[model samples]
Target: MSPELNAPGISEEDKARLTQSGIELSMQNRCGSYLQMNQDVLHAECQEEGIEVLSYRKAMEKYDWLKEYEWKAVPKDKDEITQYVASQTDPKGYVIIAHKGTKNILPIQACLYLGRETIQHVHNIIIAEEGAELHIISGCTSGGHVGQGAAHYGVSEFYIKKNAKISFTMIHTWTENIEVFPRSASIVEENGVFLSNYVCMQPVKKIQMYPTATLKGENSVARFSSIIIASPSSYLDIGSRAILEGKGASAELVTRAITKGGTIISRGQIIGKTAGTKGHLECKGLILKDGTIYAIPEIDGRVVGTELSHEAAVGKLAQEEIEYLMSRGLSEDEATATIIRGFLDVKIAGLPEALQKQIDATIDVAEKAGF
Candidate 1:
């Protein structure tokens, strides 16, 4: 084990227990292996059977862009934002640092698995040089066994160089006592493209996040898709935003959220500030029992040829839709489950079939969890 796997705030024995229990409980039957993080440390990392991200130091050496944006993801304007920056320690979270023009798929998992009261802060970085392409599947979960409650605060930043393409899929399955806050952003240079998919169909005590992407070069593109399910007593506030700051840049933000006996605020926005820029925002919500469901979608444009649009809707499964599914032989419970599941599915283009199918199944299970 390297020094990165030594969790600073946790004892060595607890680290071993957390690492083993976390991986075993949350990482079964997913990818071959994982870059695991127990709380704020690099608990363990190993190459899966087929996919790999080269060592962090090797990736830093091979990519010139890493130097330009290292540790520059968090903005310093807000105290709340800068507070997370202050919590960082070396090797705070697993990293996916790829060599220039490299192509690979990475599967990663990071969590605080200890059941005792604990606070975990993490920072994850991804760098892709010009013409490089990568696919990533990342899952974050908390094991609420002995440490009944834990707080996970993380920041992620991605640097996508010219012509580079990155597809990111993030899944969150946390316990009711776990509160999550992930602040993430991406910088896409000219002609670069970034596509992200987020799905959280599990029950969590509370979650609040609003990640953004900035298209800073001409012809750059930013796209986001998210699906969330909120159960009884669960409070989720999730948002996705895109900023088009270069001529000819484009962006899209799409989100779907489901609430059953909980409060869910679904938000998305697109801001186009340069000439010839275009963007759109969309949010759709399904309320099963509902404490509250709010969908807020906004779009703003400035300068010539800059166009923006948005649409938002929040509602429950219509009786007719549930009855129609029942006509096809599903029981009442199954019919409601099927409807909720389909409502939360928002397909992302260019996603691998295997991962997409897996995400689809995860959504179905999450959406019906409270039903």
Candidate 2:
């Protein structure tokens, strides 16, 4: 790891926790990295030639055109969380931009670590110019020693220009005492592709987020996938929406959720407003213990030749399936764990192999702990 990226007051245990959240301190296989400790920007650097990673304030100072993209996708007056972030006198976050026609196979890593018992807020903007391909992995976690009343409020906006592609994968590892609220949205231009994947397998006090994507250009594509597990004392309400406004645009939203003595509310929505547009929404949830799993899926088609569909299912593991797995000479616990692992697996089509492995490893750790 670069010395500048290594912020002080980070213990070995904290490093391990961040690693579980897919924050690589070593910076290997990362084209760029941004680390923010509390409300301070520890480091932000871009190793690739065409990619620019800078602090939010510095980026604003450098590029006057950035003002056009700021708050355009996510409205500042949308909710209290947005209002709080907009009220910050000293803004804290990172701005990453991929120049036109540039491509980086290795993703950029962004880490947000909260170490104190206070509110941590950030406003992030990510832009991919025409024909540019950008990938990002964001890890958000709280320090192990953090006390109660710690909260995180974040606002993010994504802009994918014509023929550009942006794949964003986020993993969260907040503790039982932390509450997180993230408000985010995206806009896709002509022939643009946007893929968003979220994973949260740890315990959290409360978390609520509903990200939206608008396909305003012809043949644009968007996909959102999420895998989450809620433990005891955890309340997670997550949702994703995609609006197809251009001809030939398409979108898909998929989610896999599991709850063990906790509450999980999974919601998905898709709206098709133009002819030749297609969309689908799916949510499948499993209840491991005495918990609550609510799935709400909606799809709307406004014009003729637009197709939309949705399917939602919430149920416990069938005993017949568990017995079948145990009949293969495995123990009962092993059988149950295997079934749960398979249930939570939802492969994203365009995600990189490294990020897919990271997501799988996180679920493996939880599976080893008996879900």
Candidate 3:
């Protein structure tokens, strides 16, 4: 057994259950890392490799990069709801600092269970030195069929040096009573690439978050895609932003939203500040009864040769499809839920097989829940 499995307060049962939610552990994984934050109790484990993963306390004591980007992602404004959690945050969290020329795959998981913080405050920092290449998979969720409401406020910052590449995938699956807020940012140097994939498979009461990326060097690239599903009695306001500030820098943002009920505000933006820049934002929404969907895409620039655009579409499932499902004796809600479930389907190249299987299982669970 791995020594990380022996970490205090780390539940093996939870680990096993989460594997069904797209948190896969494979032998090909690089210097395995697993973090599960249940309420205030956070447990972490990491293998020795070029990528170093440490707890917030240990990382602060060992690394030279801590505090350099403090208050950069989530500002400490008094009016910001995340400010309180940032102020009262516990000393537990994870920090991943990668070495130069390292090839790594790291997995990070967070969940709400057991009790309150039932609001969890975590500070995640990721650093990739020059020439480093990394693939990171992260998943956040709440317990199954849980009753009590919980919240998660996460502050994350990423720094990618010149020629380095970081591919990140985040999956969020929350029960009906959970609320999630994630504030994140990334800085990429010249020739660096930052790719992000986000998916929301489970339903939450309310979730509002906007993660942004800044391309600061020539020839840098940033790509972001999100797939979101909202259940009845849920409210989700999600968005992503990209700022192209370097020569030849480019960015693209695409999002797919499906609402079974409740409300979803889908927003995206791309702001270009330099010549030879290209950016676009695509927003799509699918809705059912008692659901409200709002798509807002913004593209702005001040320089010529800096091209930006957006495409948005919102509508419901075809009546014929719903009627066909109903003919199979499925209830209206179930029929609508089935169509919404299929609309959330996403097939991306190069995703891990284990992770894909877990995602399939996660979709099944979410469909059974409602949508």
Q: Best-fitting candidate, measured by lDDT?
A: 2
What is the lDDT for 92 in model 3?
A: 48
lDDT of 3 at 177: 85
Which stretch of 10 consecutive residues in model 2 shows the poorest summed lDDT? 1-10
RMSD of 2: 1.2
Candidate 3, residues 1-371, lDDT tens digits: the string is: 23333324435665544554455444244345555556344445555467776777678888666788655644656236557656763654577776898865444333323223366677777877899876676767555545665777777788888999877777776667877788888998999888878878566788888888999999898888788887887899999999999999989888888877778899899999999999989888887666888999999998888989999999978999989999999988888878876776665554545445555667777677765
Better of 2 and 3 by lDDT: 2
| Cα lDDT for residue 251, candidate 2 | 98
Candidate 2 lDDT tens digits, 196-266:
99999998999999999999999999999999999989999999999999899999999999999999999
Q: What is the lDDT of residue 152 in candidate 3?
A: 76
Better of 1 and 3 by lDDT: 3
Q: What is the lDDT of residue 337 in candidate 1?
A: 74
**lDDT order of candidates, best first?**
2, 3, 1
Q: Order of all candidates by TM-score, from best down to worst? A: 2, 3, 1
Q: lDDT tens digits, residues 42-111, model 1?
A: 3334444323443334445566765566567656434474476554554355456445676655344434
- Which one wins on TM-score? 2
TM-scores of all predicted structures: 0.83, 0.98, 0.84
Prediction 3 global C-alpha lDDT: 0.73
- Which runs of model 1 end up more than 4 angstroms from their true locations? 1-34, 40-67, 87-91, 105-115, 146-149, 367-371
